[model samples]
Target chain A: MFHRSPIQSFARHGMLVLLCVLAVFPLYWMLNSSLKNESEIFTSSIFPHKPVFSNYTYAFTQMPIVRMAFNSFAVSIMMTMLQLATSLLAAYALVRWRFRGKGVIFAILSLTWLIPFQSIMIPNYVLVNDLGLNDTLLGIVLPFSVSTFAILSLYQSFQSFPGVLIEAAQIDGMSDWSILTRLIIPNTRSTIASLGILQFINAWNEYLWPMLIAKSMNHAPLQIGLRLFVNSDTNMWGSLMAATTVSCVPILLIYLILRRQIVDSFVRFGIK
Target chain B: MSQSLDNTIAPSLSGGTIIVRRRLSKKKLRRFKPYLYLLPAVALLSIWMYRPLLYTFYLAFQKWSMVPGTSPVFVGFDNFEHLFHNKSFIDSIGNTIFYTVGLLPFSILIPMILAVVTDRMESKSKNFYRAMFFIPMILAPVSVSAIWRWLFHPSNGLVNYLLVKLHLIKEPIAYFSDPGFAKWIILLITGWKMIGFSTIMFSAALTSINREYYEAASQDGAGSFRQFVHITIPLLSPMIIFMLTMSILFSSQWTFAYIDMLTTGGPYGSSTNIYYEMYRFAFSSLNAGLSSAAALLFFVVFGLIALGLNMVSRKFAFYDN
Candidate 1:
């Protein structure tokens, strides 16, 4: 708590500034490099002497980044909605009911969290291909629709909701649907929001699965498109920077707009 | 809705038996309602997760070329035998360990120090620095690999340019192409992306420590450094150990994208980890059996570690004064 000495404070600020530069430099590089032309990119200059908008136009016209971004959005949005729906139903069932096999079910669900997606990835790929779903957004979205992470997080919060309120609503002959919508979801709004944001971000940033699942740029997300762009044209660093920057906009915008919720979600899930 | 269904169920039933049967069926359905709610998640998990998990185990012992209409032939322990002698598999196992250990300093030690250094700062500036450090963690790995690749470009990149300009090296080396530097580059890229997440986690954990502990430490005539050494470290041990365990478990995984994107485990598998190796065996080589065997081995090993982590976290869950 003490930066009592003026010299100590200066050194501390100095180190912090350097670390900040290291942190922010790559991103700043991406932005500035996108503005540089092909010949200018090879130069060691930090900024372009004559900046151009051609790279951005090239990103849109020369590549399928727009389609890829649309695909990424659709998959992430569907994945988020599906995860939320399944998690809400499952969490409510786990918390509100006195049922048989609850412990076994919970154990089974939590065990899925232990198995990383990579271990099961090969089979999912083969299965998706066999089902003729490869290169379809559905293949990418289906396997991850129900997340134990979401269910478990919601289960914890749902357990905290007043049981007396639930019971009162039930006694008034309200159905479970109305009770969940009226009584539960409204009360635990922030938890649901944090979970939704976490899920959306995860789905948006997914790389390996989509790479394995989708064969073309039509259904593959922006990350995959960027990879394809890089692999195809090795000398197009300027255009590649433009494409990467384009892919980054949605998540960056999400982080900027919902900073607190997104930060909290990362903190909460990163430890787990 | 319930009242209408009830009336429809027994409107013409004057006999007690018919009414009782209708009511009994309704009660049974009510009891079964929880399963209905749970069906979607349970079914999907079983299909995608549990089924594939069992299939991976089964496939581990089988020989399959993934040729159309050809079934997997059970060849007991052959895949495992091949795995034991496979050089890349063995190399990747070692690399995985190296990554887990190499990343420890970047993931835990540095972030802990950063979190501590910034812990007592004014909140506004604290958050700004935190956000700056956290920016990379939010970027896609493909983007990260692209950025780092440009910076480390062999002939005309910033890193080479800077090193040459500073007289570190005369020749611009191909970092990703050279075996010695390939894995290290992967490690650096992975660690660079990872620092933000760890810093944020450490900062979050620091915020949870009751400042009363620090006050109590100071009341005993302890200075700032002494308070950190005595109170802060001890209080933060749970989170520290938790992160340590996580880094060990996930370091190889966190670097997966970078390796796949930049090196492709290239220069004779110099930069490959088990995850990438498994990927290569399945996708490139089309040897599903080999990949499945590798995954089964990891599943067992990591499964045990996860169980231990859970028990350990539960043990340390209580952090109150």
Candidate 2:
């Protein structure tokens, strides 16, 4: 493509800058509001007259955000690890083995993808109560242990692995376990990492499930805890904002570090 | 060693006994290996996925208060009749449609333009702008709702402050609390958070489009805008349809969170949608039968819309690869 005239280039640049501002200004306002006092927040000045460090401190004491973050971290980590292991094993079986009813099993698994939380909330609540897993981390992670999308993504990656490599491993007198661990695992690190991060983020941001299961701050994830804060104290905008920022910082950092790999993984997997 | 060889020959009725046993064991293991590998995930799914789904459908026909010592009564079509006759249910359906209509343009069109504009920048700058656009997508939705709720606050909010400073309004406008403005404010916030995902999708779609198309357009004396209209748009139609379908499906889920956080279906049900109403009826009001009936209706309507969209997209979408 040829370059446009200088005036045209300038106009294009101006428009791009405008788009960035539109995308980012509300976030900027959020941070600004968090740092301001009640008077400053009410006044709605672009800059706070007096910056308050107490808001950040107040978030810890007021909302039990630390406990909530810890809970979220524990549940997300558990869910992500479980999802990875289960999805990998399932994908491996589907990819490597041929048997009767394999296609039917895959179809049945994919049907679960259409099953939203709203559809299953009533029965899941009943099941959780009957099992006495309510108000427990196990309850939060159990229902989320396996996702059909994760299994499909990993299955696709495994299918794309070179057949010759697996044959070579077999020729070397390697067992199935050895072939899976040494051959396939090393080759699919990028896909696994991307899926792992995605699963972790999904678990971390989940609200409705945790709200149903978690009885207190002990098991409540960050989303539910943030809701608790806004509901409990109407005057604690500063602390509430601090808590919100704290919950978001980790995922934002992960996105920044893994942007390319994650985007490419989704593109290849064709996941919306 | 000498003694053992003699004993081995004497004990074995058949030669190559070790090899025979090994082959038999391998055959047996191979028969069961796939199932063994799938056992853990299958067990979890049975307990978690299949059981709950079946039980939920069963519970739909029974009236249970979700409390102990309450016997479930079988009420076949009564719940369905009640849900169909309820005015709130109808209004919620309308509200959901209104929000979807309000959001579809901002979610699809604005981000497409942003993606095009951002892609025109140098590669290094394009990466930076891409990151900036995707910041909201990574943030927790609850936090995003809280931030927007504050911004849209009638008094002591930045939006009103800005408007007043610009001399656009003499007084502050109550956004979320006013029934007239509540739904639109929710739509705006939903659109804001969604732009990131849509922009990234479109940006990737744009980049994947071949520059040779542009070269051909330029040779024909077509300007950049004309090339975008004729070449880029046609090439990107598949991605456009894909994202549009996803946005429609996702609109219900995303708005559920916002409605839960900010409005709680307030201002006389202005912010209420089917998703929220279902939650309220099932959980708060303990009307499981009515909620199930509502859920079935929602599924039918949304399912038809999705199927219709899929069929329509087949005609317009161009698969470049």
Candidate 3:
């Protein structure tokens, strides 16, 4: 609030409103198309002439939309938990202990983050294949069981935790495990939760890895399943829209509910 | 107690004699506790990331067709030599450069402007605007592609209808397959998804800028624009540069799914980047050596860029605090 004018306000909000429409137009289009029939979908209409639920029904019943969505949800949950557990424990140790090679460990982890996962795609696929884990959810989640980014972000958060409280817990004859559970983790719950949500969303939105792993439609996550649908012989636009809409609902809902925490999490950990 | 026990043996030389004390060994278990906690993360990274990385490097030199029970033959730099002459590989590198440079405006410039313009809005309005912009960033890439695919559909898409109604063009363009438009469309979609992410980054950076600087600038007769140049630009330069680097590095990756969905590197390999081209080499062509060679090339080029960026950004960062 150093300066202001009514003209500036109008111009600012007007621009925002315009950009807002542009940002949301495609999603609005997807929803609108989902409500249209086969002939209606082929027409040049902004609004559906005859809205129908058959597209959604066909997507669910004829296709394995539910199974795919459930698969995504389950895999994301497993991935999030595994990543958080490993990252949290490691971050706590790295932060609380004065260990040899601490700086080396930190530098190495960040380096791993910089190396593009694409480079390892072939080897990871080979490893998973050789292990006979292909076409399984475990295969999809196995390679990414630890996230360097998560560990780094948690390290930063855990660094800011007050040392006196930790010392007090130690003086009270508490083990390191007890001190973590009783003092540090409870105090850092919000950070953990926000990071967990991020990891969860990342896992849910993962496309390339799951697509590579799930060699068939039966084992595919929502994104892979969506791809298979598009690649299928039938060019069912309405049902494709419906399937996409269904696939997006969980993430969209998570975004809707935890908007503030999500934004804060991104701010805390730079968007990758 | 350990110190007292040592003091009893030889008061003058206790410090040197305590070096051989076995009693201190009792705490050895606690010293390894940290490593115990770090085991899972370190082990997992070693197996999944570092091991595969070394394997990719090794595989780059070996010629193999991925056949079961077959051995790969060491072909030296033949894969790289072949890549140099290969038309698709050459085109993909050019497109990779195209995507990296193409995303700067969306990832940095536009977001910087949006954040500065709306920096002073009331809380309700600010959250409303932020929420709207962030919609695309959170959507799955496949979902985003599906939505864009519908909008740009040649026959029944809104873009075509809008173009005709406005008389911008007489006929609808098959934007994805047309060589003229495919790469540009991929760039556009990637930038669209990316704008919101960088906008939030800019907004957070802006809020962290101390309010006193703006007030001081105004007191000294600087207008809003002048304040932005003198104070805001200096403070935000680090973030801007960081974002610019990130976009340049990862923009092609962001466009990958869209390319796979819309173009499949087609109308005759017009839109394919290195990642897709490599994927094609690995799976479709089943040529592991060529694919690994390409992957190795990507890793080295980007790794050097990242190291260079770390030094440059560190030197340029203007921390107000």
Candidate 4:
């Protein structure tokens, strides 16, 4: 409640700063190594003695990174839109309408939250392969269309909406569809946006599912593409770093712009 | 004039009928509207998640290579029998536990202390430190692994380079390639990646703690540590439980991407966890039955733990309300 001593304050600040550095140093190293040549990366120096952009050039030429980025963007955007629409509709229903089996539905959705990807992944792979959707972006995006976390968060936001507003609209003979489209969605735009951004970032960074479903660079997102690059060219640390950095740019940029909203959303939803 | 009056009355009467018709349709729609809205999410989840979960159990008892033109033959308990005896599979269970426990310090203790300390700081410094701490949580895990892979490189890695320069070790250690260090390295990297996330959670939890409690505790002659123990700990216990349960449930998954990118569960299966073991069996070994068996086992074990934690949290968690 009160500052007892300057020494205590100094020590606390020092420890905080030190922890911050430790948290960020690996990322800083990735950026640092990306600018160096092959020779410089092998040395013990922290900074590149002579900065070279050749590694980035090499990364561009060696891999279909542009295509991978495009693929990542497309899948992430599509998944975000789809998840939002589904979540919004579901949340609105669960909150607004009283119905039979609502409790069962909620329990089932909650249980789905605990179902790890590993448990369902094998069968999903089989199903995807059977449907002839393997190595397709649709395969990757379809499985993620119903996010329990998104639905839960949206459910909370929708539940917090003023009941009087909905009731008043109902008395005026306004349709449920119009009430949702005009009043509810417009009011909860920020919440929806936050959830959308979180989902987009998640989809963009998705590695395991994409790794399994996407066979080639054409359908692979940035993460899978980066992994393929590393696996095939393990010895090329420079280009690996360059490609890793490139892959992180879009999400990092989005995070920087929406840092507060993104971080706050995570804190609120605890969605990891 | 009489014809005009009749015309107005006819129009009003028709409008009333139209409204009544719409009302009837709306009533019918509203009865099933919730289900209709929930249909898309429910259908997708059933198709992708719930059905696959059931299929996992089914496949666990059958043999199939996921190849077309072949059906899974029922070979009950054989897959489980083999998985139980398999050395790598058994080791992966231990490794997964090791990771979940090892991550507690990063995900719980350090973050708790950091959150409390930062909470006491001025707003400017607090926000600055919070931003810096959260940077890693936003980075993709694949990129995080790539960065750490370079740092953990045997000869040129910053870790070994620093150790040697500081006279800590005469030679660089092939961290990922060595059996002893590989799992620990994975643990370290996973912990590092999680610290920022847990820190933010802790910070949020810490901020929600009523400051008046601390002031009152101080007036009653309690030191900061005492106040934290008497006040903060009780208030934050729910969050702590929540985080611990999450870490236990998802630790294997958090390490999944990293293990794939950096080690591939390498150096004699030392770094492998249950999740990776499942992946290895399914994709690499093409043994769908064995992988399904592993997934089922993982599901039951962690599912029980999750359920247990849920019960514990309900009982022990102190809600301010």
Candidate 5:
């Protein structure tokens, strides 16, 4: 690395620190505002004069927050599991098996990455409506069951796996399914977990599709529920902040726990 | 083909015909197994993704209000003609371009600078800075919008409150309601949400650049800026092109959730992008034909841009073998 003068290094650090504050200040402000009463929230002070727990209490009373959080959690988990399973199977086949139309299939799947969700959303709504899945959790989950990006990333990872190991397993009388599960899957655990976390976070923050399908509170995910809560209770700033905080907690916790893996996955996958 | 034929012929020649038959059948089953593995994902994708895409194109050429028991009617070029003349649609297109151009500073330029700077720092401090920068990228967009909505509040918001205290403004500005401020505010918020992600990507790209190039440049009496320009940038050109293309493509969608939550694309639709406008058409107005047309237009425009970028990237992006 090139050396820098002390003054230049100091200035760089200062700028970076300032940017970091700007990056994190919104979440800080949210947590701070959530703890404040309505009067305190409106004031210009950086810290709450007297932090109160009442906003959270009011938030729980006014909204089906527990239920919504549960809905968000269950939907994200199920979607993650579904995507991982499908992606793993398909990726294994694409990498290990030579089949007719494999190139055509891969090309078609890659094209899905170019087509934005909005392009297909109207027809998808119609499809969901026909299936009578609207206003249900499955409605939100079904459409996202296949992820082209995940499969492609996993396929790339599997391409680097040792073929000798697969041959060794085959000689030991291991079936293809057994080789995939007993060897490939275990070796690529970090990649699988990284993709899973990425999918989970995406599903949790999913708004437009979930909003379209889950019209009622019972099936609404955290993002939609937060929107509805904000719309219906416009003046309850403290409680709204509290509810927003609740919605953000699970994602924030996941990010904190697996920060490196998540970033690595994003970089590897070239996903936004 | 020859290998399989040889297997059958050689087994028959060796007089192990029965055993060969069983093995051949098993080989056939093995050949079919990959298809079985691929079927679920392929089926799901075709029904959910491919079918809807075709249906979108079809619906674009038809007229429908999505009324119950009413079918879509064929209307060739009518939707496109209407969209061309529609004031809001034109404005939304302009706003989409504006968001894309406005995001460049946050998504590409600043992130590049930050990535280069952080790359030279000590390891522990580098990790700390990276984690801090990446925090916003991980936060949910709805919550990010909620916090900013409060921060941009006219009377009681922190931003306005700070401005007044600093004597920057005599009065608080209604950021979301003012047509001039609404689009820019949304842009700024989108940029803030995106910067960390782009920075992380840039950092990853930066680390992959071999240090020997930088050292040799230094020995050649090149300054830091010169080294960065000649060595760092050329090596990082591929990622730079990628980030630029991604920013342009997804900029409209990036601002959608925030626009929905923060302003609802308000103040005379100054902040509305095509994505949100399509949402309004489909859900609010129930104008399925108009929405499909818009979505199709969006796809075609972005698809062409993607194609062009592919060509441009091949020419400009430097790949070290």
Candidate 6:
């Protein structure tokens, strides 16, 4: 299989290796910078002479780093739960039911995906304020909880699920809710897992919506917290990098744990 | 509540009414069952999603900030009419297109090449390279931006240090701060972050292609490059078009967070795109009317561009299994 002509293979492999390095070196630089002192960071060096833990510790104490992480976790987890429940139900109804306006409703919902959040930022701000949800965690969690992409993707999966399962459940005296919980949810595990991870990642990376709605440390997530660190601009590169690394850890961990599922989710959701 | 009682009461009195009641009950069970299943989603999306959308439209025609007592005054199309003549809005359109133009090719082409090459590698090596490239795509954009910001730092940044060390430049070059280079730098960083995603997408698309076609091409004396151009490129067009459309749609928003973090479209708003301009108009200036109008304008223009691209790409995209 490795039978390409030597010259062609060399150029191909050479270019591939070059692109990989280009992609990964910045991450290496960040990890290295997080471990280096200011003087060491300025100097040209491959490795830090003395790795320090001060920056990591400073990132924690100086800002509301822990609080921000907690907020991100709480809101992301809640939003994910809400999303999973809502998306699963909506997908099931959309997949199984022959409602009068189902097609039109699905089309309308999908059209909302094209309406970027920028267009609605001010209106959302006003709505959030009007609903008395502004400056609160609920404010951030609520808008993000119902994702159009998630519903549609899950609907795709649910559409493919055999309908006999639900029919059998109904024959066995099962309510629609029980039929959904007992039948559809169990069968679509992989799709659910992938869509869940996709939604989780999007919610975690969200910046503008959270920034607009959430105020103070009481509700700000990791992205906003990281923004504060950078903007604080104490010329404190070490602390900034450390905070960034900290914020990245959970998602990176999730990405590693479910690498294949995450990749599939990206393609499934058309995120890539 | 009383309407429901009236509905129940009217159908229960006559023989035809009893038949209607049975039919209605069955129909209600079917229709209401789906609604029950969809209740949580419909309620949440209505209040949280659709309400914001409608409210945004409402605010587009009114001048109101977050102030408590101030009443919103409807300003008709003045905000939008104002944006038509506004230089920043026009400049933002140019800058957004500039950013997308700068980022779209690198995002699509480089990754296409990488995936093509990686597909030719040994399975073990392919897995290695895929994992390495995908590591960044999995990380948060905030982390990616922070990493690139440090890497692109003018004096102490590793980029300049490497360039000078390689004897390419005699002095440290300002990357983000320079007005001329800032937008490009932002685009480059955005493209870099996106490269892994596109590469993986292409790789997945590549893996789906049968090996027999390539083997046949090779048997027919096609060179690797020719095989790539004829076989791989044509085959991979759908993924390419999909990525291209998405990248164009999101180029401004993709860099929005980073721009907010690093530059805020600084040095005379050289890096400001429509997305950032919308944020600045709303939050920074507290001008909700102008922001909403700008947002509307950006949507109409961008939506048309996306629709046009979608139409063009439909011709070239292969739907082959």
Estimate every model's Cα lDDT from 0 to 1.
0.87, 0.79, 0.86, 0.88, 0.88, 0.80
**Candidate 1 on B1-321: residue-level lDDT in tens?**
555655765566667657666777888898899999999999999999999999988999999987768889999999999999999999999989989889998888899999989888989989888888888888889888998898899987889999999999999999999999999999988888788889888899889888888878778889988987877777787888888778877787888899999999988889999999988888889898999999999988988987887788777655765
Ranked by lDDT, top first: 4, 5, 1, 3, 6, 2
Q: Say which prediction, candidate 1 or candidate 4, comes out ahead on TM-score.
A: 4
- Segments in model 2 whose C-alpha atoms lie over 4 Å from true places: A262-272, B1-25, B312-316
Q: Tell me, by TM-score, which candidate is best.
A: 5
Model 6 residue A102 CA deviation (Å) reads: 1.5
Q: For residues B1-321, what per-residue lDDT tens digits would candidate 5 score against the true structure?
A: 636775658755677766666777788888899999998999999999999999999999999987668999999989888888878888998999999999999988999999988887788999889888888877777888888988888888899989999999999999999999999999999899888888889999998888888788888999888988999889989998999888888888789999999889888999999999888888898888888899888788888888999999999899987
Which stretches in model 5 have alpha-carbon errors above 4 Å?
A: A1-3, B2-18
In candidate 6, how many Å is residue A87 off? 0.8
Provide the TM-score of chain B versus the true chain B for each model in turn: 0.91, 0.88, 0.91, 0.92, 0.94, 0.87
Fnat, one value per model? 0.75, 0.56, 0.76, 0.86, 0.74, 0.67
iRMSD of prediction 4: 1.2
Name the weakest run of 10 consecutive residues (lDDT summed) in model 3 chain A: A1-10
Q: Write the per-residue lDDT of candidate 1 for residues A129-160, one digit (tens) a residue.
A: 89999889999999989899889888988988
Best by DockQ: 5
lDDT of 4 by residue, A211-230 (tens): 89999887899888888887
Clashing pairs in 1: none
Pick by TM-score: 2 or 4, better one:
4
Give residue B228's lDDT in candidate 6 (0 to 100): 86
lDDT of 5 at B272: 96
Give residue A117's error in model 2 in angstroms. 0.8
Residue lDDT tens for model 2, B1-321:
434554566457476766655665677789788888888888888777777666666656777777866867898877777887887777898888888777887678888888887787788988777777767766777888888877777776778888988999999998878899888888887887788777788888888888888887799999878988998789889888887777777677778888888888878888888888888888899987777767666666666777788897988788887
On the 0 to 100 scale, the lDDT of residue A152 in model 5 is 90
Query: How many pairs in model 3 have backbone atoms within 3 A of each other, for residues 3 or more apart or on separate chains, i.e. clashes?
Result: 0
Please give, for residues A1-272, the per-residue lDDT of candidate 5 as tens digits: 45568898789889999999999888888889989977787776778889999999999988799999999999999999999999999999999988789989988987775787888898899889988898999999999998988899899999999999999999999999989999999999998988888888888888789988988887898889888887787778888889989988888888788878888877778764
